[model samples]
Target: MGPVSSRKQSIVFIGGGPGGYESALVAAQLGADVTVVDRDGLGGAAVLTDCVPSKALIATSDFMSRFKAAGRLGVGFEGTGDDQHAEAHLSAVNRRILTLAKAQSRDIQAQVESVGGRVIQGTGRISGPREVEVTPDDGEARTLKADMVLVSVGCTPRVLPSAMPDGERILTWQQIYDLQELPEHLIVVGSGVTGAELAHAYLGLGCEVTLVSSRDRVLPGEDADAATVIENVFRRRGMKVLNRSRASGARRDGDGVVVSLEDGREVHGSHVLLAVGGIPQTSGLGLEEAGVEVNDGGYIQVDRVSRTAAPGIYAAGDCTGILPLASVAAMQGRTAVAHFLGDHVAPLNLRGVCANIFTDPEIATVGYSQADIESGKADGRIVTLPLSTNPRAKMRNINDGFVKLFARPGSNTVIGGVVVAPQASEMIYPIGVAVQNRLTAEQLASTFSVYPSMSGSIGEAARRLHSLES
Candidate 1:
């Protein structure tokens, strides 16, 4: 190591997304001079168009869906007979979603500036290993001297040449918020997390939804049991799911869209929402010139500490192709800053990371999965308890979903867990904690969870794992 510089370190972030803004906060707090240059507004696509807006729309859909259960709970709409229906005003909902997203973006910018970090609205590109050139919308270009540069430009919705978005009928998830009316018949192409989530949201919003999945089932990357439950629920709710259908292209019809399948079949719909996937925003960033290595898929290659191949250059978030969750990006950002500052930091343990899909009967998982055990990738014991058996679930009329736990075979230490329930995202936290701390199944079972709560099922599942071990 060379002699330590007496001056404070200067850090430049090339994006304003979760990774950049989050790490800027940490770097500023550590007494480093920080600057964040971004072309999009502060919170980036994840906040402005993707994650926040979609979730806000989903919240409205979920709330509207609850009205269906009111009659079972002895609630009445007085004079509406037994047919009470809730309507989602698309214009109003879209407005609210945009407002919330913009507000959050402003808040994130404020938080960064409050911590002594400078936020610049500009397009950033690496001019050198330690230099970032920024071009603002209306100002002259400027170069920033950075002791450390973090590239986290995030990703964009992938578009296929065969099917193009017109922003009116054919659309990407980011463009849907601009719609003034709900789609009469929405055909969603793709069945991954984003596709499943938006398809269900539209279905809940009373649109005739047709989910097109190329795989044998939806959510192929998630827990199999959870995907089955969601698929069943989608079908039960009148949404049409076409499995093993590969969309070749989509074209405009008279007043609707026609999606052509590879099998010489066509599905007609009022609109088509393409949720195929996202491409990392790594191009045009001069990564090659900076000596930062980008994989063939355009993802920045980084270690667990978020270090790129080039010295003093780090990458995080979707650009890094790590877990695409916002939480994971935030953690990566913090970890990068900590490591750069020579502060105590733990290398990111992906196995302990928790991921959640935002949908009705949401699926959440932490640590190893059942597939890992079955595939002989891990040694564990498993137990599953259905939500139908939980008193709270019964009282709430939630008939579907379950809690599954995994523990070490001999030691009984909690290794992982999967939750398929309404708000499973919230329920997975404790299991995440257990897995992170290597807590035993007995310890998790011994903890006091409120009786008649959905969380109680987690404890029950843990208790049952002990029996499996014996």
Candidate 2:
């Protein structure tokens, strides 16, 4: 920390994603001279290609899924059988996704500019500890002096040498929106969040989907029980899930593609989507020259407050390898700005952060997990209640999900929870609040939840935990 300057502190942000733009707004609002340098449009990859567009496609897929289930709810079309089958128009969906993403980018840019923050559409690099060099697409390169620099360049889809995406038969998640027609038989490689999500979305859209996973189970990084539920749902919905299968490579074969497994087996599909993972975009940013340290995987090293080792330089978002979610990025960005400005700021509490998978039966979790308790990392008791018992779930004919809660053994304080349902993302917030505030299970159970709603299961689980403690 340095002397408090009387004048407005100058801040330069490299990259215009959630981490960059969100911090720019905060820094500007705090009377700092803020400038954001970015190559792509505002909103970065999350808004433009990954999160926003993917979710938009999922929303459409979810609607189609619900429509397909109408016949079970005593709803029928004029014609019977195949005549009533619904189809997803990929062209229209892709067009809408791009349109929505661009509009959001423009909105973010407008908001930043309206707040008196400057945005340069260019590539930004840290030239020194407090200097940024920006090269615009249509203009000459220029250098800007700043009191602080924030690096939030984000990350890119990690490409494997053997299964390189051709943006045609073989595609990365980012290249999926360019598709003019739906894949006939889609082979989704990797069973991580992105792979599981897109695979489920395509399956709901009436495409033949085969999910290939190297791990024994899908969503290997998430809660085990939640993953099992999703896997069961995938199998029930007619998806071919190949576990313990690693894809060696993929190549175009006539009108379709062939994916080779390490076991000398091959799977053919109309298209293959590589959702393997992402690599941090920390290269060519002059980080080493600026004395900013990066890890072996090329992710910028940052403290909980997003400070880099070099003075006046901070890093956040995927580039920091903290958490890849947009919400986490925004929080990290704000924290970095506040810490730099000498304002009140709390170090990031990752345990309280909520994570969600947007499958048909979404899986959302917050705080300590069952794995934590079993591994002796956390001390807590657990109670799980199936959604099949929930009135709302019964009405909706959803039978494949549950709500699990964790509480301290002695105090009965709510430590964590997991929700697997239609809108688990939205439902996880209350549990998140309980975890963040360290509320007791009794407190949570006493809180009012809507009658005949899926959230009631959360209350029931909490009550059960409280009773066991008593």
Candidate 3:
């Protein structure tokens, strides 16, 4: 045999989602022999199926929304009738969405390979603390040895036994892209981010959407003020908002599906999309056998540094049961690799992470939350400004949504904030920066912003909080 290579500390990552691939790339950069085992294609479910595809459809939906409003802005369309009809060819839209997702996956694969990381398309299971068994789709199984192992198996959409996805009328969020035509009467079960987003998108695409919420509001998990605004917006757009209704089961009724609520009410629709949540994909990986601790839901218990109970093994992403954001997964992966490689590392700080809900008027939140203040967990002052009052809002004919800012009482330190408006996803970045850097409200107020802009409201809110301090 030739001379042994110097890079002997091998790192094996099971799953190629944001968490797995990110860690693998980091480990490779740190001079470790890294291998990523992915059963699905490179970018995992987040890119290949869930996040990317949904956002692509949302983009189309957003365009249609703008097009519909263009008429009010002195922009008229040719061959217009009393009822302007615009149908979304879901097949064509879905084809474009998948194409974009697959392209991104290939780009990620190229990036990982360029960094000297090996990616294997196979299902990987931890056979031991430092060994993984990879079963390739077309080839035979093989055992790979590693100095350290990172499990980032991600998760699958949770489906109730009573409402299994038929890939036809009844569908999960993933099965939606396969639909050949737009749903005439789409019934979305669950009022979480996924449900609310798709309901909004379909409604914008001119479909009659009925949103079923087990809770009182559309987005029960989000900021209360933000959820209320989105729920109102949904109703104004002619979408049926059903509250306090829990789906017991979904069954085919004649040519359509009927969602039976726990309260004995049945809602009929051409198609039903289940957005209950996700179940961690941690089983069948020999985790418990190898002394890796898992919770009741099968999610691996991990520390801030992404370390599991077992030494030389770690877990990240949805499998860790941490905040199930793609950004958090990436951070956890990076932290895991940094710790494993003896590099300077810091525990993941979730408080600074920003999350967005993609609706017609998007809802974005960062840092601390109002619940913290109400519960006395955090002492802060809040100021909310309606976007309707902004000059930019008048020009764009965007009347709904608001900007809410929270600051610590004495120091006026900007801790958390919420933005509900068009392009709120893009607008929340500055707040994320301020929260991460611990910038005070005074500092934000002193900063100048462009006149007649939505972002100006953020600065204006900061100014109001600063004046309160004076």
Candidate 4:
């Protein structure tokens, strides 16, 4: 930690998610008297329920995937293939998941406190400009004055009125880990990133999985080609994927749950997990009364610098209706703090932000998409190289996925790229740098990558793009 400057300003952050706590730490380091008021535990839903929990389970899912393919890799086990009993010890997994989440929450809390920021475990609402009212869990409400305020109240899962979760047979994504037994047949609704990842995870864990999508394909908002590849992989793994089916309602019947589609079709499973989407948690927080602007959907309206309509009040993260990513939230928080402290700050530019979807063949993309090129919004040429051609993929017996690169039409400067492979999350960083820093395809091609590596495909794709100019 650097030395705190003598200059001091009081800063209050509402919500203890990545955006709120991360910014509070920065504010404290900048010599501000910073305090965070949070309703939930530190680290927010991203840590306690959603992102961290899902990824931990995915790590196990990835191992199971590898275990199933051991025979192809010439790796042998003592038991016969048919006699193998590799059931998931779900109770044990849940215990580990909760342990990891709680540890992370405590770690984040420690980080904030170590940097001199005080944390109040309570619900905070804006009483007025520069004033926050905090209601503690077991105490009377108290008011705190601040020179600046950051509202980062994140979001909660959206549930259809007819399909409310019972927490036993029908569960939200947050409620799944509480179950002591693995779902015999898991029916996952909504084929977005959350639904796809969980469906893949449970399927890899040796359970029967069904994925229902309202759109024509899974991951409807994702890159079309990437979505197609994943949907194919889902079906190939014996997971039932029902596309063009909009779920109207879900109900518990006997020992099972049935999700009814709009067209009158019904899918039955031992359990139903809803991953429809999320609604911003900005309502009834004294926002409207404080004269801060929130949209019809309850998302706080903010400028690129994260300022709200009311003076001295700023907003960030999912609640602001910007890009709903953890990294984006952190950057927004830092930007809000810098601006509040009278320091020079650049407004957020979300164009080059990298996003990854964790599935069997993970999907990672940065900057412009294939849709942008076709729509003429971006004047770029695209080149793709399948991972099957890479020596590492062959050595590993991995035959799926590709690396797609995009370059400007004239100078061939790399503007965007996507990677679909196992651990695509890690492989996408170099391409992210190329896009973020405006590095040209020629520059990427010039870079050296180890032979028999998955990353070699990235350089090769750029090399191919460079060849078009010759």
Sequence-dependent TM-score of model 1 = 0.98
Residues 34-53, candidate 3: write the lDDT tens digits.
89999888878889888899
Best by lDDT: 2
The TM-score obtained by model 4 is 0.98
- Give stretches of model 3 more than 4 Å off: 1-7, 79-84
TM-score, cand. 2 vs. native = 0.98
Q: Kindly list the per-residue Cα lDDT of model 4 for residues 279-349, writing each as its tens digit.
A: 99988789999889988999999999999989999998999989889899988998999887866688998
lDDT of 1 by residue, 177-209 (tens): 999999999999999999999999999898999
* Candidate 1 colliding pairs: none
lDDT, candidates in the order shown: 0.92, 0.93, 0.91, 0.91
Per-model TM-score on C-alpha atoms:
0.98, 0.98, 0.97, 0.98
- Cα lDDT of model 2 by residue, 109-159, tens digit: 999999999989989888865788999988999999999999998899987
Worst 10 residues of 2 by lDDT: 1-10
**Residue 206 Cα positional deviation in candidate 3, in Å, after optimal superposition:** 1.6
Name the regions of candidate 1 deviating beyond 4 angstroms. 1-6, 80-84
Candidates 2 and 3 compared: the better one by TM-score is 2
